[model samples]
Target: MEVICLEDAAFYTLIETVVERIKEKLSTTEDKWIGGEEAMRKLRITSKTTLQKLRDEGKIRFSQPEKKIILYDVDSINEYLEEHAKERF
Candidate 1:
């Protein structure tokens, strides 16, 4: 095995680069809004009624800009899932 050492400035620069790359990856994975079908898929539900119920009960955040067009907030859905997440031993 070979050991390589980095200088203080070089180590800091490497850390900053890794952090920026992680942030870029996370930002790309995040979504501000999604359609009902995509939201349902993310939540692993198949019924439209279940999705509507969640919206009706305010369990999730959504917006209806027109008579039939609705958009779900991705952040709210993630929050809901996190709130219901179970602890593992």
Candidate 2:
């Protein structure tokens, strides 16, 4: 195999470019998902059952990326809250 090397300045520039590209990609979000704990915390609830009920009733959407893991869409949770917001005088 042939060996390739970059000088100090060139290496730093390459690293900076890679980091910027990664940041840009990360900043562009399609959908954000949160775990049960975070969702409950956001909604100020202490029961996972409540979240499960929402999922069961199809009030919100969830994803099971793994066999035993679940994630809820942040936008759906926020939308649910907005839809159910109470009227204040």
Candidate 3:
């Protein structure tokens, strides 16, 4: 086995490159969780209250893993849109 050594600057560049690659991979992965703000944007709503009401009424599914942050399942949001879509015939 051979040992490879890097100088200070080289080591930092390697670390930075690794970090960037990891970020790219994560960002490109299938995002299954949609944050509250993103969901509102997708639904063209301007208020979190509207989303909260839907959550409270069980009209939409959501998860609050933390005290202040909520995430909705992308599939559920898509289903809600389909259910509420207007037909143009």
Give the number of the best model, judged by TM-score. Answer: 1
- lDDT ranking, high to low: 1, 2, 3
Candidate 3 accuracy as lDDT? 0.87
TM-score of each: 0.67, 0.63, 0.64
Cα RMSD of predicted structure 3:
9.2
**lDDT of each prediction vs. the true structure?**
0.95, 0.89, 0.87
Cα-based lDDT at residue 80, candidate 1: 93
Question: Candidate 1 lDDT, tens digit per residue, 14-33?
Answer: 99999999999887865688
**Segments in model 3 whose C-alpha atoms lie over 4 Å from true places:** 1-30
Q: Which sections of candidate 2 miss by over 4 Å?
A: 1-31
TM-score of candidate 2 versus the correct structure, residues matched by position: 0.63
Instruction: Give the best candidate by lDDT.
Output: 1
Could you tell me which residue pairs clash in candidate 3?
none
Q: Per-residue error at 43 for model 1, in Å?
A: 0.4
TM-score result, candidate 1? 0.67
